[model samples]
Target: MNTTEIFLIAILVIFSAPYLVWRLGRTDYWAPLVVVQILCGILLGPGVLGAFAPAVYDHVFAPPVIAALNGIAWWAVMLFVWVAGIELDLHQAWANRRETGITAGLALGIPLTFGALAAAFLLRWPGWSGPNARDWQAVLGIGMACAVTALPILILLMEKLAILREPLGQRILRYASADDIAIWGVLALILLDWDRIGRQLGFLIAFGVAAVLVRMMMRRLGKADRWYVGIIWLALCGFGADWSGLHYMVGAFLSGAILDAEWFELEAMDAFRSVILLVAMPVFFLSTGLKTSWEGGGPAVFAAAALLLLASVGGKLAGVHLAGRILKWPRRETHVIGWLLQTKALIMIIFANILLDKGIITSATFTALLLMAVASTMLTTPIVAPMLRRLGGA
Candidate 1:
């Protein structure tokens, strides 16, 4: 078959297999459609599918086909990340800085510390850190992965729980929003290239100046024009960042971060997000899965994943519990918040993806982080639902 035909087949498989499992299996209670989609990607990847059926894998994921799909995945994730950046309720976070700071600080910091220690242990073994990575970069990359709270995924979960607009839910959004900024900042730091330091600094200055002009134009533009201009801005920023060795995703996030969510209609923004997820993000997920490797052995990867999970979950709960004490929050509130805050899902996967792209972590480490994220996200609803009910009861 031609590359287009093969790519179409791949796309069909990407959307179909996940939907069937998510719908027919009725796994939504334990695993949301998003989580299932991610797992399906892993199963469809070279590690599982290629191992079992190399011939079929090669046919479907031919070199040309893979290239085409990768292009789609890159843009899809860029738009997705940009939307997440735009949706960040920074105004709300700043308004309630004290509580947001305490909760967000502990929520991110403790997991990062635990994850770093876990990474330190993993460093004793080979095949975890990527070839281009420094020891410090590997440790910091893994640690930040554990600390990530996928703001987009967290928002989806809150919507699922019917509390997205509730006071508690909004509170959670504030905390996650603050952490989102930090996560990207850490990514920029991790991706910093000393050889390209001048370019990076130039990118920052150019970005600041361009951002001001864009903001000025946005304020004067019609709502419809804003969307078009915003996309153009996304592309330009992505270009600038990539040229500077900071990665285009960094630019994507920054482009959206500067925009006010209110610039567009709420319903339109929701529809846009939904459309992007339905149409494009499956490609990104599949691309991620295709990169998964068991070169270090499956058992080792799973073990590392388990360790990261323990660190991520344990640290998040500990930090939140500490914050609860200081803030005088109820015990039930702490429990619910902790589990919910620990939700990893897409953001951590995205974080790990960046690490892999920068050669800071190997595929084995990426697989481990991916598994840890899925497991962490799966635990959130199951654990938080009951605790939330108890809070409601009280």
Candidate 2:
């Protein structure tokens, strides 16, 4: 088949295999469709399909096809991250500063410490950190991976559980909102290239000036024009960030973060996010899986994943429990909140992608983090559902 035909075939398979498993197998309780899709991406990736069925994998995912898929994946993720930024409601967290500070700090700090320790241990061996990475960079990158919560995915799961607009759900979003800001801030720190500091500083300064103008433009335009201009802004910011050595994803997030969510209609914003997820993000998942490598050995990778999982899960629960005690929150709610905050996958994968791209972590380490993210996300619904039920509702 021609590349075009084969690319279409690849898209068909990406959308099909996962939906069948999630829908037909009725795995919603344990694994949602998004989780199922991520798993299938890995299974369909070179590490699995390419190893077992080289002919099929090669025919379907040739270099050209892979390149095409990557183009889509990059744009898809940029848009998704932009939406997540627009969704941030830091005002709520600020209004409840004491509670939000203690909770977000502990929730993030403990897992970071645990994951950094795990990264330090992994460094005792080789093939984990990326080629260009300094020791501290590798450790902090992996540590933050453990600490991340996919606020976008968290919103999806909460909507699934029918609590998205509820007070409890909003509380969860507030906590995640604070953490989201911190996640990007840490990413900026890790991506700092001393050699290119001048460029990055220039990008920030230009962005600040451009942002004021963009915000003014957005306010004057009608909704339709705003949407179109936003896309234009997203692309330019993405280009500028990449040119500045900070990465396009950082620019994408900043582009959206600078614009208030209120500028767009709520339903329209939600629908836009939904459309991106439904139409584009599957390719990102597959592209991510394509980068999975087992050069350091499968067993070792799985073990590392398990170690990270333990640290991420245990540290989050412990930290949340401590916060609950300090703030005198209802005892039972701590478990529910901790499990929800532990939801990882999307944002964590995005974080690890930057690490791998920068050579701060090797493909082997990326594979480990990928596996850890999948398992962490899978655990969220099953664990939280029952807790929410017992707490009287979702």
lDDT of 2: 0.93
Q: Distance (Å) between predicted and true CA of 218, model 1?
A: 0.6
What is the per-residue lDDT of model 1 for residues 301-330, given as tens digits with 9 covering 90 to 100?
A: 999999999999999999999999999998
TM-score of 2: 0.98
What's the C-alpha lDDT at position 316 in model 1?
93
Candidate 1 regions off by >4 Å?
none
RMSD of each: 0.7, 1.1
Write the residue-wise lDDT of candidate 2 on 355-375 in tens digits: 899889999999999999999
